[model samples]
Target chain A: MKQRNEQLPPGIRGFLIRMGQIDRRWIYLAVAVAIAAPMLARLRFPEVPGRMAQATFDAIESIPPGSRVLIAYDFDPASAAELEPMANAVLHHCASKGHRIALMALWPLGKQLADDAIRDILLEYHPEKVEGVDYVQLGFKTGNEGVIKLMSTSIAEAYAADASGKPITQIPLLEGVRTIGDFQLIASISAGTPGAQQWVQYGDSAMPDAFKFVAGTTGVQSSQLLPYYPKQMEGMLIAIKGAAEYEMLVTEKYPVTRSADRLALGRERMGPQFVAHLLLIGLIVLGNVSMLAARGWKGAAR
Target chain B: MSADRAQQSSGAPKSDTRLWIALLIFGAVGIFAGKLWRPGPLAEAYVEVVTETRVLAEVVPAPTTQGTSTDVQSAETVAPTSLEQENAPTTRVWVELDDPRFKSGELRRVEGVATEVWDERAKVDPKKAREQIAALESDAEKLSAPTDPTGLTREEFEAREAARMNALKVVESTRIVASPRDSIGIWIAALLTLGIFSFLVRDNPFYKVVESILIGVSAAYWMLVAFWSTLVPDLFAKLAPDLVRATMLPGLAPSEHPGKDFLLALIPLALGMMLLWRLAPRGAWIAVWPLAVVIGTFAGMRLTASIEADFMAQIAATMKPLVAYTSSSAEGAAAGSAFDLGGTLAGILGVVGVITVLVYFFFSLEHKGVVGKTARVGVWFLMITFGAAFGFTVMGRITLLVGRFDFLFNDWLGLSP
Candidate 1:
């Protein structure tokens, strides 16, 4: 490929080759503009909710109001951009339906993200709900899937106390909750390993009939989870696109008295996403064109 | 990483002075814009109340038309006087109330049925309240002693202490005031995000500092969480003698004997200590035993879980009826094809994709003739899956970029489209 670039003509052929080999910083700048410009312009696009997201929403909706729902916050800040929107939206939906949430985290930083979700979404919108009654923060437990394994058999064994060193027995919401089976539904918003996969194995597979399970995961992680969709996993929200679509469904059904930004972060973020994707596609096309043009010039030279 | 690598690459910038100056200017603009940014109007639901004002009781018993209702009425009547007496003093002592309603034997029987009627409401069936009352009584009994005097049953004691430690402080009234710390947090977050994104231009000191801080924070945070959440609860609390635990964490009530999980907890603690032996100058080979245990455990768990969840389950799901003939379909109608051609075709293609991909992976046979053609088809399927995955990955990265941009523009700059 390098030799081919050098053999091209010194005029346009040379320029095409140079374009193909342009500094990565320039591409970065192009991407930044592509994303920022669309965001600034407030470009809105319609999203058709996918089957997986619909299934996820349906699963949560199917559960009786005030049912115990265990939400495992399993991603860090690194993947928060991809996972948090859906996490927030899901929490909002759960809270709106008056579900008792048992929030836990597998990753250390995931606890902070969960706290953010609690403070921003759960607390902000649903101030009427009392902590330890409406919801309980289990915080981030170490041992990864080992925590899930312990939780499946006995949640008390896994977490003796809530995040703030409170006993689980004292939590009003978790009154009779003994194990993961005690919950009516389980939702895990995850990024990588020790995430949705671990939950599926320990929480779903271990007790398939115990509770319904759903996942909101990064786009890259979605492929790994596809096998479990609507089977082991009742529903799945794939990345921000899924988050946006699910948000639309949720807000349309159960509107909240909050800023549109707070209610629809995923959809709001999608504008930049669309433009960036277009830019990427354009770059790919340009690279391909440059490659083909250079090849033709080299053939003529030969 | 880029700074070091850029030095060896042809794309290295001549100087970073301009970049630093630009970043400083951007930072200034961000801080100034953030100061100008005002929070949106609070929802009508957000009613402010002073911190010490306890307006409404947190939990209200479910309305019932039975003996339980009578009991609730009596409790309500008596509650104000008792609450006033308790609240009279500036410093209130946490008291465990003894419910004289149920005797010990009756309480145990009711406790046995608690889990069964946990989800069922007492309003529907009055008998369910017996279980609830039993649970409430047991909770009170557990609080009788937060710490075990003897080393026989610490689990119950610790649970009570955890509850006591985690008790929610009752507030007189509620307020949802937006704190100034929140705005400062946004500014810090925006600045950090900018510092990290600055790498897109070129590796700079700002990015390096933020990156280093992130790494350090991550390590420290992980250590803290692991120690507090796992080592304390699962290992130390389970294996260490009550005296040691009491001495180490005086704030925490002492638990009795580790109970049934003591041996189970000890094994892992020993293994972990052995794993740490690698830090020693000599006999570091002892760590291999624990390392092997960890690896073997993970490998075994992954092997079984993946085969069942990922492999077998996937294959089962893929093996769908090629013809989707519903019960409602007419006798003459072409099975599944008549109702949903798209679904039927998709099912067939999925089955084909799986077979061809499997055949392609089966390299024991030579790639020639029919096998070669199938292999080519398999390659096409693989390419499509990869392409889709690549698209998703790109979307994920773009979303991250968008989130940062949103913070910068919406939160920091207060810019609206």
Candidate 2:
């Protein structure tokens, strides 16, 4: 290693070492440029839906039209950047398929996110849908999995009234609903605990065959949820990439006439994602090269 | 010492000059960039349409001597004697047109007054309610009869009954309207985001101030949310439904077993009060009891839930056939080539990883010879898993950063195309 380094030009070796020792602020600046530049350019790439994305799409599609679907917004604004796109996409997909939707939340702020989806996606695209007849908002419950357990037995007991304070019994959509089992499909867009995991445990385990279960989780939470995929979870969407792929499949099947940009949030975000990943790969390569060069330098000195 | 002091003095101004130059250059670049990347028009301002309305005054009269009497039928039949006069002043209220009651005709518009009112005349009278309940019961009985004429199923009859019961419950009508968006909020958010990013340059007062505000605001927000969403609804409503409905939640549904619910709610209320007693000057030790109870109950609940959900479920999922075969099509059944090589390899890999990881954690025996090799393999698997987790964490973090930038550009500056 020493002989090899001695044969190489000192200027090149010194340059590599200097690059390694460069200020971290410069690296931050580089990353910023890499992300911001691509975003400003409106760069976009076509997404080919993968197996997981396909599974998620199929899960919702397999259910008959007008079948009741419960979407648990288990994420808050903190993870909205990652999960909101998928939430919007899923809501649109379900509504487009004419599924009678029920929205609930585990996290306190999750209700707000659900409300945003209702306002932005559901109401915007499907204005003809009546509130009580076509859909309902169950809102947030205090008990985490306990709520799920209660719902598994009886939804009315779990939620006496909807988010608007309308009695669950009075809601035309919930008339025939006895329990969580009444829903044809259940999807949980989750960030952490008391989320998809809790749903799988308390909700799915109670009546495994009653309804199909699917989940959309943040990248970090995906590892924890991976074990439940293909079985407990009939479908799974992991992070922004998953969101983008799912969004593509959804929009392809059910294209919106107005405000198409709303559904394109995930794909638009993928531009910065591509550049950031490339920058990361570049930094990793640079760091490794620097390490090798320094090692050779040390050997030559010895 | 004099020479060293001179060198330090000379270096100080040089560093200061360099800092000033850097600041100047960055500021110039930022200004020029902002100009070059012109933003789109500001978001349109939305207005909430609030309409004035009148709601029925929810004034329950005091019980009369006749009402207190043990004659259940009499109590059910007689109207309250102290009912308020019809000439009582109506209060003015503003409700959003979006309220469901407006659509349901529960809140009807006063034609001349140009405001909606909850008709006091439409209030459910005690006698009428009894009659309605009796009628529903008779209808339900007919549906349940051996030779049921009504085609309605048992569930459908029950659902109608439930709806009737819900309608009979007395609830106060109230107004609700959303707060309009303000520019002040947007500016504050943008400044705070920038302040946070300023930390990358160096620690400064702006970053510290932003950090403190974020912490304080988040804590206060969480506390308020918990109080209103959890404690009030779950605890107070159960304990004192009428009071909660009257004051905080006008829409709180009537409970069937109020007595049982109150008794059950009292246990938690007592525990909560004890927990809060730690803030007092005396009997701080009382808090420990509730804490212990909470921890014990939580542990017990989590233990059972984890065992059933995580342990058993995961084991069931992982115990798969080592050799996975492709589902043969009707025509392909005779071909004798339905082997799914990829799935089989994945299954085998999963089994190997699980076994090796278990071997690594087995500290009962000394890790030597075959055990050492297996443990090493386990370490490799563990490393791979960790690397994947780390990559995911990084990806999630970057996405968050991207989100913040998206807000700054699209929302704040409207820079993105």
**With candidate 1 superimposed using the best TM-score fit, by how many Å does residue A59's alpha carbon deviate from the native?**
4.5
Estimate the overall C-alpha local distance difference test score of candidate 2.
0.78
- Using DockQ as the measure, the top candidate is 2
lDDT of 2 by residue, A1-302 (tens): 12333343369888887777766777887888877777777788888898999999999999999999999999889999999999999999999999999999999899988987887799989999889888888899978889999999998888988998777888989888898888999999999978998898788755647479989999999988887888788899889889999999999999999879889989988888888899999999999998899899989878
TM-score of each: 0.65, 0.74
- Candidate 1's displacement at residue B205, Å, is 4.7
- Candidate 2 residue A261 Cα shift, in angstroms, is 0.8
Q: Could you tell me the lDDT of residue B145 within candidate 2? A: 39
Q: Candidate 2 lDDT, tens digit per residue, B1-417? A: 577557645643455447745874885588458747774443211222333544322122224534321211112122233465445433222344455545544344434544454322222322233455566556655544343328889888778766655544311121121123534455678889888987776555678799999999999999998899889998999988878876898657678899999999999999989999999999899999999999999999999989997788768878989987786666564465578899899999999998998899998968899999999999999999999998888767878988888777765664644
Model 2 TM-score relative to the real fold: 0.74
lDDT of 2 at B351: 92
Model 2 interface Cα RMSD in Å: 0.9
Error of 2 at A7 (Å): 18
